[model samples]
Target chain A: MAKKRIVTTTLNGNQTEFLCEPRQTLLEVLRDNMDLTGTKEGCSNGNCGACTVILNGRPVDSCLVLAVEAEGATVRTIEGVATAAGLDPIQKAFLEGAALQCGICTPGFIMQSEWFLSQNPKPTEDEIRFNLAGNLCRCTGYDKIVRAVQDAATTWQDHYMKNCHEKGCH
Target chain B: MRDFEYEAPTTLAAAIELVAKHNGSARCLAGGTDLIDQVRVGRLTPDVLIDVKKIAELNVLEHGATGLRLGAAVPCYQVYGHCGIVSDYAALADSCRIIGGVQIQSRASVGGNLCNSGPAADSTPSLIVLGAVAVIAGPKGRREVAVEDFCTGPGKNVLQPSELLVELKFPARAANSGSHYRRFIPRNEMDIAVVGVGASVVLNDAKDKFVSARIALGAVAPTPLFAKAVGDALAGQPINDETIAKAATAARAIAVPIDDMRGTKEFRLHITGVLTERVLKAAVARARGEHVDCRIGH
Candidate 1:
């Protein structure tokens, strides 16, 4: 084992610190060191986005990122999607739409979707499909996954609009 | 994966010194989309990983009167998303847009793609057609290499062990000039290109004749090849189907394709001509101030 270095990052809105080897990937650090296993590892390479996580507001394959690279970065993983109140709307949409068969790729799909929606709240169906191209699902054939993202986008838009109205924000 | 020492130097000089110290046992880390994968597969066992993302000079993306100065570490997404790059350098933008799925683009850098030296790298042909120049920094100071000559062979480049690519510089887009890139793939998204063609043309004042042209092909050879014959055939020629067909034939003649799993040599050769014609036509249209989607053939 090489020397384990301390990495400080903001994970899921919480300032966190953990010890990891330099060779360990961000996915490994999130799962093993931080106990945030929601970010699954599928290909372990960049081909599959099952290990997708939002780093500094951009969705990237955590498997391709070194653990030390996440130092001083803001990381949002699958475990960060749902709040203390309840499941995030995207997660809820995935469940309601039955978007997963094995569920191995769900967390990645949800994370990418969240980042996509954050950038474009009212994305078209084509945009949704293109945005989710990195993620792979052996089951469900992606129709349900696409539908789930659409559902989530619509629901989230309505929720955001309502909150803005309450806050007197146009 | 082998454990390696990691150093993120904020200055290019420091990074160069680190690599010099490690000799050939250190690898510069940019986005790590490619390097980390190689490390995980045991293909690379660098004694030290010099993370260059923290180096400010290597992460710049500037568009000025001279042209575009793309930092070596600028992510593919940033390159594609930059309005100036997308508008002025359409061929490069098309290549960046299709480099990988969105997540890969978020971290993959064009410089990394070039340095990776994959024969089928999507960005190489476009960069070559755009006449991009790579700025390399090393213990010996800095040097510039034309993008077309950067890759020596598959998975090989001319970079010294102690050197790092600092940035890529593209010439200013000339008036009445347009560029286009197209690739044949088994799938629409997230697949290696079977045959890639990038074409750029500068039309005469009337926009009916080609004043100058450049054609570059990828995936059909050990390294991305500039189709000089094709460009020479189109120079000062009337921009018509006849000239386009002749240029395509020249492209096919020069293609040295291999029988790869993605495509047969014959298939790649055939598509090289086909894509060359299509890309040239699109480039001509773009040069005529028309908006053309280069990915239409995908």
Candidate 2:
């Protein structure tokens, strides 16, 4: 028997610590040990983005990350996206656009979309499609999802630009 | 998945020492995009995983006057979008852009892709066509091997168990030289290549004759094989329909593909011909200092 590895990560704005087997995935650690189940697992091979999470501000499939590999890193799961009073803008737009059906893939999609919007607040339709290529939703045929992303982009741009203007970048 | 010990060493020397300490019981963990999945599937069972992501030196892309030196731990996304090396080596950039999805790209390191040594690896042909050299660090010390001779078979590489890929270096393209890469896949994204081709060409004045050439083919052999015969055919010839046809035929003759789930031997052979023609044309256009559009319709 091999020794269990101790991992500490700042998960969802909280300092979280857990012990995992060497083979334990970050997705498993989040769901089983940490009790943060918002991150789901699908197709454990990384084909499906159901286990997506923001690792150090980049969206990566949780299933593809070893729990031990994430030591001393910061992780943002779906549960961390919303504020105390409201959902994130992308999540709000997703709800407004009715972009989800069964909702199994929504968490991952939301996380990925949030990262994409951060990089490009005013993404064109083509840019949105390209950025979202890794994330898929079996439901909604992606039409409504694209619409939601576009809506989020507009909101994000207006808010970000206004904030930037207020900061006196000019 | 079986249990194992894990260690994340902050320094390159520490990472190498950890792997050596564990001997054959350890594996170097890169992006974990491929290593983790393999571990969960029981295809690999290293008793210890030496995480090398914290080694900053292994994650750099250094550019010099002659060529580029890419750290092994640099992610595909970094190579695709961030590295200046890609701007000059368009074929490598294009290949990185098509590897898996954004999430995979974020975690999949260029070194892991090369060290995985899969015949279908997207970066293999790209590096091969550009004449890249892999720098490896092991208990014995450091050594270098050409990318063209790095892989021995499926999932096999020349690296010893104690060795870790440290860096990848390739000469920058000379003036008037252009490189192009293209692959045929069943789907638009998140799929492996059924047939991949990368070609680099140096065009003389007016793009009349090829001063130098390199063509590397992937997914049709045990290793990513350079199309030396095709390169020979195009080396001194003018960019013309006749030359392209002959080069394509030459490339087709080198492949002996197998029947697999992604594609059949017959289809793979056919694609080798088609991709050869496409890449050569695009490479020629690039060699002439013109932007060659290689984007695919979804």
How much lDDT does each candidate structure score? Answer: 0.90, 0.86
List clashing residue pairs in candidate 1: none
Predicted complex 1: DockQ: 0.76
lDDT for each residue of candidate 2 in B144-170, tens digit (9 for 90 to 100): 999999999999999887888998999
TM of each candidate vs. truth: 0.96, 0.94
- Best-matching candidate per lDDT: 1
- For candidate 2, write residues A128-167 as lDDT tens digits: 8777778878878998999999998887777645544554
Please list the residue runs of candidate 2 whose C-alpha ends up more than 4 Å from where it truly belongs after superposition: A160-170
When only the first chain is scored, the TM-scores of the models are 0.91, 0.91
DockQ, per-model, please? 0.76, 0.75
Candidate 1, residues B1-298: lDDT per residue as tens digits?
7889999999988998998888899998998988999998899889889998988888999997899999999999999888898888999999998888999999999999999999999999999999999999889899999999999999999999888899999999999999999899988789999999999999999999998999999998899999877797788899889999989888999999999689999999999999999999989988898878544333
**Could you report the Cα RMSD, in angstroms, for every candidate shown?**
2.4, 2.4
CAPRI-style class, candidate 1: medium
lDDT (tens digit, per residue) of candidate 1 on A95-149: 9999999999999999998777767778888788888889999999999999998
